[model samples]
Target chain A: MGKLKVLSVGALSTIQDEGRFGYRQFGIPQSGAMDISAMQNANHLVSNNPEWPVIETAIQGMKLEAIDETIISVTGAVVTLKINEHQVPMNASHQLQQGDILTISKPMGGVYFYLGIGGQLRANKDFGSYSTYIMAGFGGMEGRALKKGDILETQGGKPFKKHVIKQGTKPSMTETIRIMKGPEWKLLKDLPERTIFQVDPSSNRMGIRLIGDPLGIDGKEILSSAVIPGTIQLPPNGIPIVLMNDCQTTGGYPRIGKVVNEDMGRLSQLNPMHKLRLKIIPLEEALEKR
Target chain B: MNILKEKELPLLQFNKVSWDLFRLGEQSLLLQAPFDIPIEKIHDSAKLIKSVLGSLLTDIVPSYNSIALFHSFEESTIIEKLSTARGISQKKSTPIQKVEIPICYELGLDLEHVAEHSGISQDEVIDIHLNDTYRAILIGFTPGFIYMDGLDERLACPRKANPRKYLEFGSIGIGGEQTGIYSLASPGGWNIIGRTPLHLFDYKKQPPMSVEVGSEVSYVRITKQEFESWGS
Candidate 1:
């Protein structure tokens, strides 16, 4: 089996896959890679299945040492990559010899980075998912972030020819994202068409809190109802919170709308204080885009 | 005339309820019953929808008055299938899984505060809590967190002004008019009255949560020593 040891890690680096599913009814957050496409791309570069668990680092980068020869690739968020002392390119696979140190620095833009291996990382699987949910402590590397001295083993595989992904495939931080009206759309007095919402600095996997001109509406609390990723909720304060992968299964705020699935990946990559606009579209039109 | 009578009888007995369908997201739709409808009817409707959709649905999350259905089929297909399916039956199945949770009232951090606020003695508060049985209404907010109904209104207390940063698993508390147990350690604002020794959630088990919506829950008072010696 191929092995890699965590030499050092930055903030919030944990193992993530597509996400744990079919457990939201039990209140389990669908913990997974924030930027879904990036995780899939990283896996593809390493010739692994798109859903294979990968190390997801937030903001800052990490350091890993190859304990056994293996193939590795990095994707998501613009970050400087290195092997020992030599600079390397991202979105491309490289063969790592034993004892080689791989370094990834803080991202130049975006907030999350994904590092994938050529084969499945044999970590704890809870509810048929390898994704880590740190709050409850169940999945991936003892249900915690990657730390120094931690070792990860993968199913050994032969080195394959190197592969690289094309540019423009990575998600771009767009100013406007498309959305469809939610259940309580009528409760909204008006949509913020001219005003741009700023992403709150405290935003994390649970939801993206927006700082903008409060929509002056008598925001009444709805009975707790089901909420999924991308469901934009308007709290009593009128600031909207766009629910993400790790948001609670149910909430009491007025659901204004949900960002279309296609734009969700791009929305996740936006940094704090980033400007955002919502383009409300019909359900049929939104479906057509998909 | 015979066919019309048979069709009309089933619809009448079942109440032939209509639900408001809202498109929650690209892949999810929410069916909402009227507020006046019993939660049991809502649960039955969710079950009926799940049965009708079968494998087409990935999840069917039921709440007090709404059900969210997640699926990959077209919106029109789901709507069409739901309209043609048999109506939600009114048969009520009494929940038999009554879980007796042993609580240590000595561990209650807010016992004095709760007693003062409710104008009752501390011993009276514990007695009242243990007297009534509660039904699990909805489980959400966090993993395995059970939202139970049937708290005595006299014992109802406002949530803590500042929520605790960390509540141990099996921490039982009262928030507003509802009472609940923290299946996992989590930050919460409920007024803590006691804690249970049972590990309500075991990830290794097939169904991680032993109790679910509609399960009956009643608390039994135990001493701190008994709680400490629970597993042994």
Candidate 2:
């Protein structure tokens, strides 16, 4: 068995796998890794299954100490990685000794970081997922974010040869993202033809609020309906809200656009003050990208 | 049929309806019934797809007139299944269980506000709330938060102008034409009128939620002493 002790936690970090599935009808949000490819790349570095639980840290990073010898890798957004105050290479696995201190600092611009441990960390599986849905208080590390002194228990595995990620695989932190018309796309009246939006500070796992030219539409409280990640909804105030990984199962707001999965990944890594441009594309192309 | 032409569809006796299937996202598709189709048919179709798809489907979200299916590689299969679902009869050999909820009106903070807004007495509000048999149409917004219809128009009230930061768990409230109970405490804008003593949701149980979609729910007003004495 392996153990990892948390020394300091940043703004937000939680244990996540693919997500808690098969529970949306009950209104349980699917809490999963924001960027799928980045998470899998980190897992590949440590030779773990892509779906294995990993620590997802926000723009601000975390500090931890290994209580047992194991291998670890970090992915998503270029960040300063340190081991015992010495810089270490990211996107590559490194064997660690007991009591080795690991520190991850905020990225230059990215919003999410993933720490893929070599051994799988165990979490309470509610509805067959290891994700921490903090709103409901039910999964991952006792259903909340890791705090100082929180110890994570894991199944230990022998360290394999280091795995190195090829260059240029990581997605560039692009400002513009691709999107497609939503079910209620026609309702957008004053979309400001070519205006760019800035990510609002109120963004979180549930959804990201965008500050831009108001879509200039009033809502009549349409029948509550299903929504998913990448769904862009325009409320009565006309500000567009992009639903993310931890969004609710259903909503009543008017859906105006959907950021394609390829760009929802880009949207996920963006911090507040990041610029956003919606490049309207064919729905077929958006589905094809997946 | 254009949606703007209708105020709302009838409550019962809808037949031979067809739903339009639109791709929602990469892995999600929505089957929307025409405005003329009854709301109950929407739920029946959702139940059919949910049972048929089994593990192949992820989330099956049902709203007033549509069901959104989150599928993996079974898009064609889901389309095929939903296409044939209209002919399937909505029936059950087992009786649709009616879950009785115990509410303590004393615990609700907005009862007086709800009464004053409706220009009715507080007892009339409680009486009308208890008089109707609300059917659980769908579950969303939060875990186990059931969207129930069939509230009397006399008792209907709009949501609070300013939503509370945190509503107590099990707070029963009305939002627009619907009445619901919060399964989990969170910020909400509904006009709260009562509170239930039931946990309503427990993960360790066979089914986490006490109320399922298509369930018929009735309320029995209980005293605070009775609610406090109720065993887990």
Candidate 3:
């Protein structure tokens, strides 16, 4: 058994795995790590299963004190890591002794950082998942973000060989996101593929709201239909909102396109106000890319 | 002998009910039926797809005139399987399950607002709500939030200008032409009329929700005392 006491949580941090599945029919959002592959890679570095729950913290950073001997790995977002004031490289596994203190700095780029421990983190499971869905107040550390003085407990883990995922191999901040036409794509009057869109600061796990030149078409409300992560919804305001991991199961906005699944992890890492452009791809190319 | 056996079976109709299947990215498919089609038929098609796809599908969402199928399976495989399934007869005679929800009108946060909007007395509003039978059409927006149909045209009211940040579980509300109860405590924009004592959603239970699409719902008025003592 291992324990890590959170000294300070600088931003929104919660436990997340891949996500909760088979619950969208009930209108439950699939809340998970914003960058799924980064979370998986962090778990992989710690010798944990890719789907095991890990601590997902936003850009502001956090501090933790190891209460027991454990192995930990950090991934996602370009963040600075320090152990007892000594700088350490991220995307690498580090063995921590009892009472060791670890500090993670805010992302130099990107938005979320993941901390993976080499064991299962104890958390409440709702609808067969440990992922936190804050809107409904269920899952992970009593259904809320980690706070100061909170203790995270883990069970059954053995440190494997410490390794590092080479920089640039993993998902990084990207300004170009590939997309495919959605069900309501035909309703769009103009397709501004070359227009550079800026990520809105108000964006969160629920969605990445974008600000750019309006598509010059009124978004006619459609019958509330099925929506999934990566769906780009155009509301009456003409601005686009890219549905993220915590998006609702259904929406009434016109779905113009969906960010390709392959680019979702990279898209999640884009910092607020980061400029990006959408590239619409053919279905054949999308299927091939996947 | 095989030909004779094949001749004994009923001829399968081709394209009797068709939905336009479109791809939503690589992992999802959206099948949209015409809006003019009956919602029950859409529900039937959704059920048929679920029964056909079974474990291949990760999640299936049935909306007003569309069904979204989430899966990692090859899109062509799903489309082919659905095409074959559509030819099969899906007519079933299962009786509709009716749920009588006991509501306390005194708890209605916007009861007077709805009464003023409808130009009717509060008692008449309650009477109209209790007498009509509603059918759950689609469940979305929030977990276990069922959108029901069969609202009286007289009681139709636009959604509140500002949505409430929090609505208690089982709070019944009317929005535009739709009427339904908030199955879970959520932020909503509907004009609430009453509160039901029945728990519409319990996560610990096997199904979590007692009400589902196609279930019949009716309100039963109860006094404050009865509401307080419910399930005690």
Candidate 4:
């Protein structure tokens, strides 16, 4: 088995697989890698299953040392990568020998980036997932984000027979997120023809707080009901907040729209202060794209 | 006995996603029925839909009144199968199973407090709670946690001002008009009343969850001594 020693922990870093599904009934939110495309791309570079666990870093990257020789790939958000102070290109595979130090600088754009090792990242699994839920303090490394001086073990499985690296193809960085009208959209007061705005800097994996016109609906308390990942909730203050992987199982706010599943990934990658347009697409078209 | 009601039930649109499509992520979509329908109608519809679409779907999760059909986002055909199934309206003839749970008064840590808040006697609280049979409204939150409705209005309680640090497994609690059994020890705000000895969740089991949405749950009171024995 091989291992990686964390020398400098970034702002936010955690190990995540695809995510824990089929457990929402218990009030548990789905916590997984923020960017599915980046995670999948890293896995594809190493020819591992796309759902394999990988290290997800926020805007600021971290520094790590490979204890044993291993193959690794970095994907998601343009970031500077270096092996032993030697610059390495992003979105490509690299062979690191024993004692090789790897450093990922702050991302040039996008909020999160993924680092995937060829083999499984050794981490405890609870409730059928490696993702971390900071609020509940369960899953991933001791159920929390990685910290400085932490040592992570790797399964050190065999390397891929062929390394396939796909050159950089920037996804449309437009802040516009497409959503379908929610069940409670009618309950909103002073409903606007359009309420989408650019995502704010405070956004993280937990949720995206949109900077848009308030719905201006005032009402009494609502009955608690089920809330899915993409449900856009308008709190009493009227600002719409889109729930994500780490959202609560149930809420009592009126929702106006649910981001079609296809656009969630793009929404997840938006950097702070990035302007996003909200487009209303028919539910049938959204499902057709799926 | 009359099975159908005389009053006309409001017609609701049932939405279903088309098959042979992968819309958002790797998740296929199947809209089983409308939201906010009567509990009995939703339960019966979900049961019928599950039996009809059981073979095609794998993870079928029912909520307040809607059923979400999930499958690998990679499978394009799952969408088509779900939409096709949604177009058909068929009622299942299979009998629904009901499970009785044994609850101990000794574990009813908040029962006295709840009674005080509701201006009812402890004995009255117990009587009202056990008098009415409840229906499992949904199975969500954690794996195997059962949310049942039909609690006596007298016993309906709100969640704690702040969620408790940890709730014991199998702990029966009430929040607002809903009653539920906790399958795992996790943070909760529900007012705890008692506990059941039966395990609600076991990953090793085939179904993994013991109770399904739409099942009937009855609370059978047991003495403290019997609870102690059962605990052992």
TM-score of candidate 3's A chain against the true A chain: 0.95
Expressed between 0 and 1, the share of native interface contacts present in candidate 1 is: 0.80
Cα lDDT for residue A143, candidate 1 = 86
Query: Candidate 1's residue-wise lDDT over B32-108, tens digit each?
Result: 77877787677667667767789999877889888888887887788777777654354554455788899999999
Interface RMSD, all models, one decimal each?
A: 7.7, 5.1, 8.9, 8.9
Clashing pairs in 1: none
Using TM-score, rank the candidates from best to worst: 3, 1, 2, 4
Query: Please, what are the lDDT tens digits per residue for candidate 2 over residues A1-290?
Result: 45778999974889888887778888988888897777888788888888888888886878889998768889887788899978998888877789999998877657788888887788878888888888777778888888899887678655666788852344444377787766676566655336688899889888989898777765545677888888988888777899999998888898777888888767887778777777777655776798
Q: How many residue pairs clash in each candidate?
A: 0, 0, 0, 28
Q: Which pairs clash in model 3?
A: none
Candidate 2 stretches with Cα past 4 Å from truth are A166-176, A186-195, A214-221, A236-239, B1-15, B51-55, B90-95, B116-121
Alpha-carbon deviation at A275 in model 4, angstroms: 1.7
How big is the positional error of residue B50 in model 1, measured in Å on the Cα after superposition?
3.0
**In TM-score terms, which candidate is top?**
3
Query: What level of docking quality does candidate 1 show?
Result: acceptable
How would you encode candidate 3's per-residue C-alpha lDDT over B1-232 as one tens digit per residue? 0111111112322135767766666788888877887888777776777777889988889899888988868877877777777556446635777988899999999999999999999999999988899999898888888999999999999999899999999999999989888888889999999999888889888778898787898888899999999999
Candidate order by lDDT, decreasing, is 3, 1, 2, 4
> What is candidate 3's local distance difference test score?
0.85
Model 4, span A163-261: residue lDDT tens: 656644554555567777665555667544455466777887768897877777757344555566787888888878888888776666876668887
Candidate 1, residue A78: the lDDT equals 85
